[model samples]
Target: MLLLEGTFPFVAGGVSSWVNQIIRGFPEVRFGAIFLGSRPEDYGDMRYALPDNLVHLEATYLYEPQDNPPVMPVHAAPETMPMVECVHKLFETDMKHPDCAELFAGLMDEAGPDGKVSHEVFLYSPESWEFIKKSYRSRCTDPSFVDYFWTVRHMHTPFWRLREVAVRCPQARIYHAVSTGYAGILGVLLKHRNKRPFILSEHGIYVKERKIDLYQAQWLKDNRSVFERDPSRVSYFRQLWIRFFEHLGYVTYQAADDIVALYEANRQRQLLDGAPMERTSNIPNGIDIQRFAPLRAQRSALPPPVLCLIGRVVPIKDIKTFIRAMRTVTNHLPEAEAWIAGPEDESPEYANECRELAHQLGLGDKVKFLGFQKLTELLPKVGLVVLSSISEALPLVILEGYAAGVPTLSTDVGSCRQLVFGLPGEDEAIGASGQVVRIADPEALGQAALALLTNPQAWQHASEAAVKRVEKYYSQDMMFERYGALYEKNFKWQA
Candidate 1:
């Protein structure tokens, strides 16, 4: 079973593409998937056609409104109060307490039928209320107890929703979660319930990304007055949310039999974040070289002065940074044009803002929003592939570009630097495939593009390096072989 959160059928991005590739790559294995999303309205039609081997697919929305049970004063069982106190202490210790796994298992047990710490008990039990109040009195610095109350309530509501999903999910010999968040927690629950092997493949560090989201979230209440607030300190509510996610991530780490990261740095991060060293490994993303290799012949001998950033139009992608870089690119090469070839439906506001910024910079027709385009058709015509994301894993686009004989210019984020310059040994000997600039630096981004596009010798060297690196290292067959071995090992254990 594959536990997915906000990726796959509903969304179209690198992770979704990877999921599609994995399902299609394994025709013999019968697969089941559970997709968790925020709400029905947030997604459109299915982004990818469901594969035949995917025998079962289920979707649940976490934020969907349900009729509330009647509010009644209830008292928690005496045994549950101790468990609740331990839960709070678990968070206090940053979920590194020796008893964390045991504590989580106990909590999961109590979430069962007529159990003391079930959802209803959490909602209306007087012991639960007193525990919340006691924690607020001791830890909350913010003035509004009401805000704290609602925030705590809102934060935990999803746990029950996920629990329900876990209860009904189809059984699989092994469970695979693409990232650690709600889906990871569901993986934890299912692992405990079924006593099955659960594996995690983290494309981006979930806790770190959630921290970024919580830090920027404007809707989280900060009741402190300007004089009382410290500009440098994060708001109490934001910190609360961060800790909550950290606790969730830590539990997920403990539950997973094997933790997979896209690269070594992230694997180390998994260790720091509580994944056992023995259980963690690295599995970089890969693409089909054969699919894109033919496009190399279609490219013009004189590369076009076109730069393309192919991904979702989300804030994390930093579309504005790409737009600002185009302003610089056009100034250097008058005929240069920037093509943003991805779906904008993910964040229409951000997309609109990017378009407005381009207009304000007088880019006019030099900047184009091509929505979504076929990479086979798009790559052959483009001179350079650009990635201006603030965060990423091993982006497949770079490898795809390399296979099509185009070099990439990307920010120094995730494994982009490694992908561009190669790894330490033979990978490094392949030579620098492209350029890597500091994140959010438009001037550096544009200048780097100019350096590659204007010089044919330099561009050819980068292109050759790109093709060699991807062909040798990041091909789909290599990725499939590794994953197939993993699945086979678990399947034998199941037998």
Candidate 2:
């Protein structure tokens, strides 16, 4: 069974694509899926068809209300404060506590029919009220207790919702979570319930990204009463949210039998965040060279001076920087075109902002917004593929670009630097296949793109290096074999 949060059928991002690839890659093994999303209204139609091997699929929205909270009050657990203290200590006390796993296990035992804690006791009882007030009085720096009251409720309300769905999940030999937030919590919860193997595959560190979002979040209620506050320090509520996720991540890390990351950097970060060293390993993202080899044969000897940025048109992709970079590219080669190809539905306002920037830069006909093009049709046409994302893991686009005989130019985020220059030894010996520039640097990005697009010799060398590097190290067959072995080792199932 796979527990995926905010990805798969409803969303169209890099992680969703990877999930589809993994499911389709292993045809011999039947699979089950559990999808968790923040709210029901955020998603629309399913983006991809269900794979044939998928036997069960359950989707539950965390924020949607199925029914009102029970009106009758129930007796509170006498020992609830210990579990409550264990959770709150993550924020109030030291984060790197040695017995966190034991504290987490104690917290885990406070669920379901047999557990000491109950939803009624947590939501409405006097013990819960005293705990909330005590936490606020001791820790809340802001003036508004009303906001603090709601923040505490909002932070923890998902536990019950997640537990409800987790208990119903179909029995499977092993459970895998793509990331370590809600999905991780479910994986841990399910493992506790069934005594099954739980595997965690982190494409991006969930806590770090959540911190980034929480810092910039406009929706979070801030200093409504107290206006004069230091701007540098994070708000109490924001810190609360971050700490809550941190606790969840640590708990999941402890429960996971094995943890996998796309690169070494993330694997190390997992250790820093309390993942056991013995359980963690790196398995790079891969693609099928044969699938795109035909596209390579179809491409012209010299790729046209066209660039494509294939991803969602969101702030994280930093499309504005790409549009600004285009201003520089068009200043030299007037015919050079850039295709911003991906879903704009994820963030329409951000998409509009990008279009407006393009217009302001006077890239009228020089830039085109091609929403969701067939990769085979589009990869062969562009001279180069670019990613201006402020954040990423191991981007599949770079590997895909390589397989299609096109080089990539990416911002130095995630594994892009390691990928371009290579990881070390045999991988580095494959040589630099592309350019890596600083995040949000338009000038450097523009120059790199122009160098590859305008110079035929340089572009040819990059294209050759790209194909060689992907074939040497990152390919779909390689990924399939590794994952198959992992699944077999855990389940001892012969395919």
Candidate 3:
């Protein structure tokens, strides 16, 4: 079973594509897929087609409002106070505390078959009220209890909802979670309840990304004025949300049977975040070389002086930075044109800002917005692909660019460096496939693009290096075989 959190179908990204690729890889093996999203309204139409091997598919939104309203006021259980206190202590203190896991186990039972602290008891018991008020008086720095009340409730509802989902999830030999958040917790619950082997493949470190989002989120209610408060003090509510995700990651880390990362760096991060090193390993993302090689035939000897950033135009992608880099590129090479190619619907506001920024920079005809073009179409025209993302995992676009006989100029993030320079062996000996620039640097990114585009000798070296590197080291055949090996070793399957 695949325990996907906001990836596949509803969203289009590297992780989503990777999930689709994995399912398609194992044609003989029947598979189950579970997709979990934050809210019902967060997604649109499915972005991917379901694989033939996918036999069971279920999707749940964590924020789906209960039809019955909040578990209503009801008779109190005697253990409610202790249960409430346990909940507070788990969040209030260190998550690694031995008691925290034990207490969470009780919460599983309480939220599960054991009725000591029923949902009603948690929602309406007098003991529950006392614990909330006590925790408020002691730890809450937020001025309004009203905001605090809703924040705590919002932070916790998904966890209970996920447990409910776990109860109904069909049996599967292995539970593989793409990222560690709600789906990770569901994996933990399934492992605890059904003793199913849980595999966690983290394409991006979930909690680290959550922290970045929470830190910038303006939706959080901050009572203090910008000038009045010290910069050291983050809004209590933002901190609360960050801690909640951190807690989920810790618990999931403890429960996972095996942990996987896209690169060695992320694998080490899993270790630092408490994943047992013994159970963790790196699985580099691979591409289908033939799928993109045909595009190379259409490539012009002198490809257009156009650079494309193929991803969502969101803050983490730093689209504005890419636009600024285009301004610099076009100024130097007047014929240069650029395309920001991906879905903008994910963040229309950010997309609008990027579009506006492009015009504001006077990149009128030189820059275009190409929404979700197939790689075959885009790869043939563009001289180089660019990734200005402030963050990434192992970006498939870089590998895809290589397979298409085009090189990428990317921010030195995630596994881009390893992919470009190759992995310190025969692969590295193949030579640098592309240029790696410092993050958010328009000047450096622009210069790198101009250098490769203006000089055919340099561009050919990079392009040849790219195709050679991808064919030798990164391919779908390798990824599929590696995952098949993992499944074979871990589960007795009817293939």
Candidate 4:
């Protein structure tokens, strides 16, 4: 079973593409996926066709309005109060307690239908109300009790929904979560309920990404007045949300049997985020070289002055940075054009903003928004593949570009540095496949692109290095073999 949050069929590119590849790669294994999304309206039609091996696909929206049972007078059981207190303490300490695994297990049980503090009890009980009030008075720095009350309630509303999902989810010998947050928590619950091996493959650290979202989120209210607020410190509510995700990650880490990261640096991050070091390992993303190898022949002898960023035009990808870089790229190479080849419906506002920015910069015909083009068709025509993302986890596009004998220009984020420059020893000796620039630096990005596109020798060198690196290290067969071994090991344990 795959516990997927906002990825797979509903979304495309990045981790979703990798998930699709994994499912298709293992034609023999029967797979079930539980897709969790915020709301039905946020997504459109399925992004990828369902594979034959995918036996089941269940989707649940976390933020949909709930039809709760009518409110009734109730009190928490005496035993439940201790567990409740432990939960509060866990949140307070950011889930650093020695017995956090046991606490998390107990908390899951208490949320169960037969437990003393079930969803009904939590919503309608006087005990829950009193506890909220007590915590507000003791811990909350924000003046509004009303805001505090609603935030706490809203933050926890998903637990019941997840519990319900877990109870009804189809049985699988092993459970795997693509990312943490709600999906990770569900993985924990399913593991506790079924006693199955639970695996976590973190494409990027979910909590860190959530922290970025919370910091920029306009919906989360900051009740403090400008005079009362400290610009240096994060708002209490924002901090509260961050801690909430942190706790979720901690619990998931505690429950996972094997935690996989895309690279060594991310694996280390898993340890720092409370994952058991012994259980964590690295599994870099891989792609089909055979699929893209033929595209090399289709490329021009002289590389085109076209730069393409193949990803969703979302804020995280920093589409604006790519546009700004194009402004500089066009100044030197008058014929140069920037192609953003991904779906824009995911964030229409941001997409429109990027278009407007291009217009403002007078890059009228130089910039193109080629929405969701197939890489096979797109790669052969492009000169350079660019990644201006603020955050990424060993992006598959780079590997895909490499496989197509196209070099990359990416920001020094995630494993971009490792992918571009190569790992130490023989990997390092393969030579730099492309240039890595500072994140959000358009000037550097443009200069790097010009350096390669204008010089055939340099472009050819980078392209050769790219093809060599991907063929040697990142291949679908290599990735499949490793994952197949893991699946077999877990299946044997289950038997």
Candidate 5:
């Protein structure tokens, strides 16, 4: 069973693409998809179509409360008091403790191999809750222990309910997690309940990505008073989210049998967060290389002095830098044209800013915002592609550029150097497809863009090198083969 949270079939993002790829790659596996959403209403008009091999589709929303009444708060009963206390104690200490596993094992209800549901065993003993409340009060810096107790209850009461639901679900030999947020945590609980292996695949660092979004989020601001008074100057709710994500990382790392990341950078982060290095694998993002391969045949016809940048019209993409670079490039090559191709509707504010920058630089006519273009239709006519992102991780746009024999001018961040220019391969003079400059440096970016426009020989060499690199390393077949090996190894399947 694959547990997806607010991505996969519902959302359109890097993680969603990876999920679609994996399922399509292995049609033999009977996958039961368990989708977790923020609200029940959020499920409306989801576009992804399920494959034939997807035998079961189960949906659960995390933000929506469970139907059953709050079952008398686990602390109310004397008989179950000690079990609750033990769980509380386990939650207090760091997850790395050897004793934590014992506490987890105690709460599990052992199901026989015959697939029979066994008698319930209390894993979270009452004693666990008492110790947890005590620890919460002491470490939490709360003046009143009673207040801390309810705070913990209020925060994790839903999680406890989720755990209850997970332990009672139908059987699956393996549990697959899409992201390491709530769904990843559910994967941990499901593994514990079923005594089955869990596999966690991450397209993006869920905790880090979510932290970035939540740090800039506006909704969580209101809950600041309930949790703490001005806890960690950067939003109390943000800290709470960070802590929750940290706990999620701990649980998922501990429970998952195989943890896979999309790139080496992400894999390293996972290892630093306590995932065993031996269990981690880096399967870089792949594209339909063949679709762009035909562009190679038309490379000779591509318009010279044409520079194109394709991506979402957002602040992170930093289109202003590209526009500023065009101002300099236009000064050098009067015939040169710069095209910005992407959806303007994504971030109207950023789009407006870029438009203003273009006019302010007096290159408004020179630069064209060809909004939301199909790259295949546009790439054949473009000579160079630029990625002006301040932050990125193996952007698919770069790969698309590579396959089209279009060299990239990218900021040096998140595998950009590695992708465009792999480590010097046997003294080949540092196989650089294009230039990598520091982020937000318009002059340097302009110089790089200008140099490529004037020097036809250099541009030709870069394009050829890019094509060679894409064919050698970044092909879709290579990614599929690597992932197939990992899945088979973990699933214990024979050819």
Candidate 6:
């Protein structure tokens, strides 16, 4: 049996999709999912239906305060005493301190040969809290140490509870973490305790994605504590939160037996952060080609030269860039229509900004903001699909566009070039499906899209090439085979 923690049965994110792929890939292994959440409301219907291979499902919420606090020794063993000192240092210093790196490496070196990791590292250490309070007062001039201390205390209190929960879980041979977050850390802890192998797979870089969210998230600002000194800098609370995420990332990298990433960029980051190069692997995300195959058969009733953009309306998606491109595209092809097929009101402020840009550009109805609709129903209507996202990692939308026989014009990010042009005949020519433009460049995006819409013969060549490329390199079956091998090899973890 394998214990799968955190992402699978809980959150509806890229990590959750990876969790589903793994479970669905291996049916023989009995997998138990330990879902961790902070609040009852956050635990929804788990939109990704649990697969039959899932033998056990258990959930723990961090928001519920523990009924009984575990006791910690005023002093620990000699071997463990330095860990206490390390914890104090960790809680006191900001992330990126070279000392933090040395201390974590030293702590890992101190783990017992039996792999019995002491819980003292995560549990409340009086020495650590005292240092934290003292450092909090002196260093955190903006937010009073009193406020920062409580914030740190609240964010980390869950790790202690997670430790207790892991100890109670049914013994499993392998531990797989969907991503390196709190739940991933629990998997690390469990593997150390049981001496089992731990495999971590990440679809998107969690800490990086979380950092993006944290920077834009309004909730942190609403509750920011008053700092007595310089208030000019960004909120101290946000800084503390980012540091915590950095710590989690570093810890996850240090402990994993193997680490997986969706792209080369993310892999490099993991290695740079602390993961050994040998332990890291890149496995691009997979899509069910069969699902889109049938959809491709149904052609659009609309006329040719239709350009569509399919993605969330988030700022990162750069919907504004797409709208800007639409303004220039209309100059050559008056009959051509560009459809912005996604949620229009993701961020009311951002949405308003997009609409205002369109109005200023004088494109009254040239770019239509259609609300969210099923891609299966909408994708066929479009001939040329555009992805203007500034940041991405093997977007599933592009794959869907390919499978639907719709050529794409995407920003040069993640695996776009590899997806369009098959890697030099390790396989034959898997035709170039679309053009890759520099991100955030409206004119280049417009020109590339114009080429596809204007030339039918060129479009045909690209579409055929796209189908071959997907069949050769981006096939879901190929992905399943690779992941299946990885899971099978580590199925029987040694404790």
Residue 29 accuracy (lDDT) in model 4? 93
Ranking by lDDT: 4, 1, 2, 3, 5, 6
Give the lDDT of residue 350 in candidate 6: 89
Q: Estimate the TM-score for candidate 4.
A: 0.98
RMSD of each: 1.2, 2.3, 2.3, 1.3, 5.8, 5.7
Q: Cα deviation of 453 in candidate 3 (Å)? A: 1.0
All models: lDDT?
Answer: 0.90, 0.86, 0.84, 0.91, 0.72, 0.71
Off by over 4 Å in 4: none
Whichever of 1 and 2 has more lDDT, that candidate is 1
Best by lDDT: 4
Residue 459, candidate 4: C-alpha displacement in angstroms: 0.6
Give a tens-digit lDDT track for model 3, residues 1-495: 999998897899999999899988889888899899877787998998989899999889987767534656566577667776766676666667755654675577567535666666666767767777888899888778988887877777776777788889898888899888888888888877777688889999999999989988989997766676678878888888888888888888877777889999998888888787788887788988889999998988875688988998789999888889887888889999888889999899999988888889998787899899898888999899899988899999999999999988999999999988888789889888779999989999998888888988888889999999889878999988888888887796332
Cα lDDT tens digits for candidate 5, 1-495 = 888887667655445656777677778877788888777765555547888887887777766754533334232234344554555555655667655544554443322212111111222335545555656655654355555555555555446445655866677877888778778877877877667778888766777777767776766543335556653476434565677777667667777788988778889989887687877888887878888989778766433788888876777688998898888788888888889887576458779988988999888888899875777888888878888886777777778888988888898877788876785563144377887989988889889987876787888888878888777777778888887787677677321
> Which of 2 and 4 is ahead in lDDT?
4
Task: Quote each prediction's TM-score.
Answer: 0.98, 0.95, 0.95, 0.98, 0.77, 0.77
Q: Which stretches of candidate 1 lie over 4 Å from their true place?
A: none
lDDT of 4 by residue, 78-158 (tens): 877778888778767657676676677667677876788788788888888888999999988899999999999889888
Q: For model 6, how does the per-residue alpha-carbon lDDT over 1-495 read when each residue is reduced to its tens digit?
A: 333444556543345666677678778777888887776664556657889989888888877755533665643344565564566566455444545544553454444322223435334556555656666776664435556766766885766567667668887777777677786677667766677778887766768777887888787642444443345666777777887787777776766778988777779978876677898998877777877888766864332677888765778788989889987789998876778776544357888888889889888678778865677888778878888987777777788788888888999876677777656775335568888999899999999888887887788788778776666667777788877777767765454
> Over 4 Å off in model 6, which ranges?
1-15, 42-44, 61-82, 88-129, 137-143, 217-239, 300-304, 330-374, 422-431
lDDT of 4: 0.91
After TM-score superposition, what is the CA distance of residue 414 in candidate 2 from its true location, in Å? 0.6
